[model samples]
Target: MLEAAKAVFITSGVDAPAKEIADLAGVGVGTLYRHFPQRSDLVKAVFQREVDACVAAGPALSANHAPGTALTEWIDRYTEFLATKRGLATALHSGDPALEALPAYFMERVGPTLGALLDAAAASGEIRADVTPRDLLLAVAGLCAPVDHEGAAFSRRMVAFLMDGLRYGAVPPEPRG
Candidate 1:
């Protein structure tokens, strides 16, 4: 049922009516409400599921691909995830106090996995010491501009450049003593 609700939410936006979710889930309205008392509850569950998927991708990518390649692909996936969040932004910022913790939720749930991947890349000398996980995350976040906005492409290009700059042998500007 949660998966069905997420599918509907992703396709129709979280503001999609409960009846729509119920119909998609093949369940009655009473059942939907019984499972999720409020729209915020459903939204929270869906967002958490998405976040979990993204977090889980980190290890899978590292295990299957080279560290550098994994980091790059993960960044792309993170950008896509943010884009999906942008699609559901309306529901995210709908003044639901319960949903307010999502940013923190993402940090706690996704940040560690990202940090581990980044640390591995750094240890392997695939990225620079100054490059923190949050820096890469912020670059991806920057890609999530206003929907239908022209700047999104430019943002993506810039993030690509930034990620490329993170490759092995990237050098920090020398400090003058």
Candidate 2:
């Protein structure tokens, strides 16, 4: 249900009917309600699921690719995560205290995972040593902000530019004459 809701939410926003989510999940509306009781409940579940998926992808990415490649690929994943997150932010911020806790929750879950990736990349000498996970997250968030579907390609190029910046000085300058 959470997966179905995420897909529907990306296309239809969080206000997309519960029946739509249920239909996509191959479940009945009653089943969806039995699990999610309220729309907020469903929204929170989807949000947390996305956070979990993003967090989980880090180690796998780091393991499968070189440090620089892993960081770049992970940034791509983070961009996608941000895109979906922006879609649901409005509904999640509508004054529910529980829902309001999600931003902190997102940082708590994603922070360490990202930190580990940064640590590995820096230790491997693939990116500059000064960049922190918080810095990267904030930068990526800014790049992705004011989400414009039509501007996705532009956003991606901007993110690529940011990644290039992170790699600045990764190779020591040629010895001066």
lDDT string for model 1 (4-67, tens) is 7767765788877888888888899999898889888888887888899899999999999887
Clashing pairs in 1: none
State the TM-score for model 1.
0.80
TM-score of each: 0.80, 0.90
lDDT of each: 0.79, 0.88
The true-versus-predicted C-alpha distance at residue 164 of model 1, in Å, is 1.9
Clashing pairs in 2: none
lDDT of 2 by residue, 93-146 (tens): 888876998989999999999888887887777888798888999999899886
